[model samples]
Target chain A: MEVQLQSWQNMKLAQVPHMLAGHAMPWVLAARRSAFERFAAHCFPTRREEEWKYTDVSIIGRRSSLAPDHIPPDPSSEAKLLAWTLASESLYLMVFVNGHYAPGLSMTDDLPAGVRMASLANILENGADLPESYFDPQHEHTIFAALNNAFATDGMVLDLSPGTVLKAPIYLLYIASGHGVAIYPRNIVVAGEDAQATVIEHYMGTLDAHNFTNAVTQISLSAHAEIEHCKLLQEGPAATHVAGIHAEQASDSHFISHSFALGGRLARNDITAQLLGKSCHCTMNGLYLLNERQHLDHHTRIDHLAPECISREYYRGILDGESHGVFNGKVVVHPGANKTDAHQANHNLLLSRQAEVDTKPQLEIFADDVKCTHGATVGQLDDDSLFYLRSRGIDAELARSVLIYGFTNDIIGRVNMPELRTRIEHLVLERLPQGDQIKELL
Target chain B: MLTIKNLHVSIDDNGNGKEILRGINLNVKAGEVHAIMGPNASGKSTLAQVLAGREGYQVTAGSVRYLGQDLLAMTPEQRACEGIFLAFQYPVEIPGVSNALFLKTALNAMRKQHGLPELDAMDFLSLVRERMKRVGMDEALLSRAVNEGFSGGEKKRNEILQLTVLEPRLAILDETDSGLDIDALKLVADGVNDMRSPERSIVLVTHYQRLLDYIVPDVVHVLSQGCIVKSGDANLARELERHGYSRVETENTAKQVA
Candidate 1:
């Protein structure tokens, strides 16, 4: 084991001390050292692994040189962020530029009492005390998450006290700029009993910038707490994004996750939910609109470890051009977890002949009294639907656009926030050929 | 306003064409309501689909003319743009698209086709609100997906709603009374009767003469074995209803010579 990864391991280990954030705090430094060691020990997950069977992460492994920028927001990138932040005034915005928290651009007006929001990097630099067990040593299930944990410079550490609920959503915006730049943004949320809120994690890069964004968000909901976690990846066209979302729901808590992957040359997301207590409900819904040569893969797992837990996973992909999409969702009902209900579905619509999708829905049920159902489909637009639209004076192209938009509405409609829903609707429409005309119809 | 001369349509299966509509001839003038009554598999619905230019139907022979133009040469949307409407027997349920948006898009598309300015959302909604109320289509359904989870009667009412909103010149009602109840049937029949005008021609295709009892047709044509075997005044529909198609079985395949 010493010689197996001595040189490569040392090379990656060198990035620990040089990481842009979390250096001043010894606990953070220790956490980073262990995470980097673990990441290097495993190298990068390959096709041999069951989870990474379809995706090839060799490109990321080669480009994983940690050169995160510690610079402030540029005028142009700030302008673009300002436009978005202004558009969603109802959301508390946390802005991060080049993996470091941007205090100038971050907005937290009207923050309620008992709600704690702070920059993890600042907390570590100031030598603040973190919540107990905040840094889970074994939570990094994949190399990407480990890498993020090790190389992450700055992140949002949100603490919602028990019985405290925010009426507005909390938006975390991470912007990366620079050629071949790699930025890791990690987020942690701790909600006490009966606490509820919606959090939007959006990762974007400057136009035409080549970058890699590896992000991880760990959320724990207390009893009766509800949290809607939305992850939107809109990086540059030449960018690569890898994200891991790990959530733990207590008894009677509700957790909803929506992953909208529109930009980036290659984007992969691993979303895992642990329903640890009884009567917890988790919903995982995602929509990916891919075009050109983009590639996206989503791997989701829902573990029902307690009795009477319900989990629903629905993911849809619309692929055009020569793009490829993949979705593998797994639902596991643990032993003796009776009365567990799990449903999983993944559907892909290929607009062009060359577009392709690989979809698989897995249900591993060890409990006899549990109910589990899974379905997957990869196909083109329904001819009947197209013809129906055309019969109403809508041309073939416009009809196709409307039907495609309609297919994605199932996921978008699940979002209760009007602003987020409209933004998602716009992105899905923007990928279609007749999007402009369809917009007028609405 | 519409004429079919020696029309034939077939569905291709394994490189073989099985004809559904044999050689047929018919003429429909403006402001006239013609009832095309036939038994199941009598090519009634196929004729309507072919008229609307739905794909999978290879027009093996014949020509259809509307307003002196080649009707068979247009596409489904083009046919709709040119003032032809076919209230589908089974309206397709399009999830995620609201009924109001569908109607607005269709109405604006037709208006744009006829060189008329498009209506804005407010004007369009106002126009739709009144017509939808007239057809008894609940205002709440306008926001719901098109025909998604709608009851049978509600679906029929939606069809009448579209018919009234579009206001086409040549309207073909294909089994519109199939799944509706007596009250719904009367409501739909009244909707159709209200739309009858001197500038428009209507075709009511039904398996029973029950629909004609509400909206009396000027002419009744009995289709058998893919051909109009019999044609007469409105009295013909009642005679065929009383005798049943078995009596008309003797008239099977007797092609009508126009």
Candidate 2:
């Protein structure tokens, strides 16, 4: 609880002096007036708050005390950051530096006929936008998201025409290179009726620069529309990340979101999916691997607001060294949402004796006729399985490494995108302590 | 080629222990198959586990020599590299790993330990295809996760396929015939028979004589109270099948005096 005050009262306002002197145009400054006011009224949440009890952001706030510098990153470091991308021939790559759209690093080709990809600045300047009804306050549940809304400079926007089938996926990469800085980025996606596309948001750092990234993404899918959204978080070690994703699925629409967390000193993701139309389906899957003194948290909510909607969620974590992981998933079925089917599961594998995992899967059903189940498991590797492999001539240490890889690989393998799947596999393998043992595996 | 001298094993870490493998002695040379048959609670499986160097069993007194080398002194992988294989009654399911890939890694590990070239993908494919046909396994099974969602028969067949790929000099099958139908038993037996060679040895541990009917052993040993009380040709298996294990144990005591 003491840590909460440090992160909120002191660190939240420390950057105000530095930010006020920062450069911005008159029109852009005018646009952010309301956002800055909203941020001032609502500060960071304390540990006493039920939603933030398990995760203390005070450590992150202390780290964010140093103001972010606007100086662009070096060319060599930018090349290294782009090297981690696994984009394919059909992907339209959009790159960002210091949370601002970087046109020089981005590549645009093979775009669909009725699809638009533009920066938030351009959208604001040209007056293009999503329906006003889609915008809602999510920061009431997460104070960091409100901070992101308050400081967001610019972001990416996607607009699809009805009945358009995108042949290639859109790749959005976010890079941070400044030292002791904070960057807020936002992404808005709208899928017209009967449209289908896949979007990949990748995060990486150009240098070992100490920084903070606060991001918010809002997605709205029309009836009969489908969207596959995947986020990859592989930030720098000294960095802190706070991200929130809000998705609204209409009747006959399908939305799938996959989050892979493998970065930062402290990271937390808040994901919400609201099924507002009948026969809608939403699947949320996530995998997190942490080591060193890192802390990672995931809070997911699925609201079954309409009848006959189905939702499935599975989140897995592997904590090593002195790391900590937390999972809090809740499925809410409102009244009159009969025939709703929802399932949530969280599984954690603790590698070291000192590693810890806190998991809670909650299911609250108000409808009379609905099926809901939730379970959480935290345990070490199976001794029987390990012995089975050792008895076959594999060394005990190698056997443990293989089992660990196989455990997390199940979730990574669930990704339908082939290139992205392979990239995540490589990243996961590289992050393991016994990465050398897996060279033979690949 | 294996020799066990006064082999004794005890379960549990307790120092004041009840010995599982009492003073037992056995010897077998190349070009022969030996079957160890016993009732439930007997130490037939313990003997196989000890020979494979699995943990959790304390060897109070014993020395085992395999092909003129100290078997118990070597690590599990070392024994594997030296051509020792165990076909488990219940194979472990390894998810997210393809059958072909798992086999290739195991095969290459053994090959590398033996100073041989690692088998490439095409070479492994050719080798697996032949083994699959002999085991009556569908070729498509190799692309799926190892033993995951596989039928009982398929799992057994997959075990046989791995055995064929490894081709160890000594194979100790720990109740491989425990869970199988008549057709599956025949297919598995055929796979074992095809693997038989003049320079290789086999030890089949089973509670029933059905497996011996297909792959007849050169010798059948009856293990009772952690010791071998009777040893004879394949006829011992048939007699025990007809008279039951209790009758055999009593008869062995009587024959000891005669």
Candidate 3:
């Protein structure tokens, strides 16, 4: 705990509120002056706070010593960080080095007509006038989100033309580099009316690199628009990754988000979707596999503001070694959101005796006629199933691993993208404690 | 070959030291099909369960010898590896496990324990395709989850299909014919008949003689009050079918037949 606090404090120089005022966000920093003042009036939540009770981020608070007055020139860590980005052949790649866009590695030539994809810095310098309206005006300094807003030096800015459908996925890689370095990478995606597209954000780092990633991404879907957004975070084991995703859905729009987290010593992912229009739909799915003293937490909130909107969420986790996992989900049905159909479930498989899980699935319904259900379960492999397998001559250890993987496979098999699914399967199997024991079985 | 002598069994879960098998005795040689007929609560299934080494059934006093080994001493899996198989009365539906995959795993496990080379996936598929035909089971059934979404008859045929694949030395069919139509009964009987060999034996547990009419066991024994009260050839099954258990008990009790 002390180690984590020290790490947090060391990151104070790169803190969101201070860094925002110091960097490219001067206009936003000035526009949200009162909000920033309100942010400063309240400190980050501690363990005593009920929302943060199960997870302790004080270790992040302790990393004040690592903070630097200014970003280092020619950061020695950029090379290793760039090499870890997913370089799949089919993806239209956009790379960010130390939170700065590196156009040298980007290949965005064949983007569909009327699509706008550019670095935030380019948009700001080329008289694009994104203005303060693009920034989340409703967001107060949320500590981490404010920190990301303050220090976001380079981010992907995407705007789709009305009724345009992109055939290929847009890949954005946010790489955090340098020892004791901290980065806040922000992304803004806006889809015009009747547009459809898929965007994937990759948060990655090199092996053993000590850094912090505080990122915020917002996606806006207009009337009749559809979007599929995915986030894959596989940072270095010594790194701390905190992210917030906010989505606003318009009339008859649809949004699907999948988040996969497989790295970092401490990681927390927060997602909030506001269904503001009638007949809008939102689906959220996540998979997290943690081992070897890792801590992973997922907090999701879905708000149905209009009638006839539907939201569904499913999340699964595999915890091994002494790792800890936390899942907190809430589905909110507003007064006018009658006939809202919302379902949320969180299931965890603890592979080791010391592994632990804290799960809370909630439904806050104001509309009486809505159908809302939520459930959370944490358990180990069924011993009867294990014995049944062992009776078929599978060794005890192999039998247990098979059942555990099979339990989590229910979610993995749902991932329709073959390559991503295969890669994730390998990653999950690699992190399992006795994964080798089940090789023959697989 | 399978042999049981003076077997005594008891269940102690409910704090009642009640005996389920009261000094029962039975013998079965290779190539023999012996049917144990009894009413409900007559300890018929208990005898089959004891032979399969199911947990929680205490063998208070008895000796069971299979292929000259201490059958009572072997674990369920060990008993399975040594060619002992039990076709459960109510097959458990494993939601995500495929039937063919399950049978392949069971077959390969037995083969591995016997020091035989395991079959490849293609070989296993071919083997399963052949055995399923003998049981008159639909080939499509293999692609489904094990017994999940299966009808009662499909589950019964699946058990017989397993019997045909494992080819255990002693097959204990625990009421395998309980919930079956006439067509399904013939298929199950055909499956059992195909597995009969000079080196294999079988113990069929049932409460009715309808199954016997199709399978035609070599011997039939009336099990009443936890003990065998009568033993005879195939004609005995026909007699019970004609006169019913009460009449058989009367005719046999009057003679004090063993």
Top candidate, metric lDDT = 1
- Compared with the true structure, what per-residue lDDT tens digits does model 3 show for residues A155-180? 78889988999877787876666676
| Model 1 regions more than 4 Å off | A1-13, A72-88, B252-258
Q: How displaced is residue A178 in candidate 1, in Å? A: 2.6
Query: Model 3, residue A236: displacement in angstroms?
Result: 5.1
Per-candidate fnat, comma-separated:
0.75, 0.49, 0.17
TM-score, per-candidate, Cα-based: 0.95, 0.93, 0.84
- Minimum summed lDDT over a 10-residue window in model 3 chain B is located at B92-101
Better model by TM-score: candidate 1 vs candidate 2: 1
Ranking by lDDT: 1, 2, 3
Residue-wise lDDT of candidate 2 within A277-331, one digit each (tens)?
9999999999999998889999999999999999999899999989999999999
lDDT of 3: 0.77
The sequence of per-residue lDDT tens digits that candidate 1 reaches over residues A186-240 is 7899999999899998887767767788888889999999999998888889998
Please give the lDDT score for candidate 1. 0.86
Query: Residue A344 of candidate 2: its Cα lDDT?
Result: 89
Note the clash tally of each candidate: 0, 1, 21
What tens-digit string does per-residue lDDT give for candidate 2 at B155-222? 88888888898998999898999889999999999999998999899999999999999999999999
Model 2 chain A poorest ten-residue lDDT run: A14-23
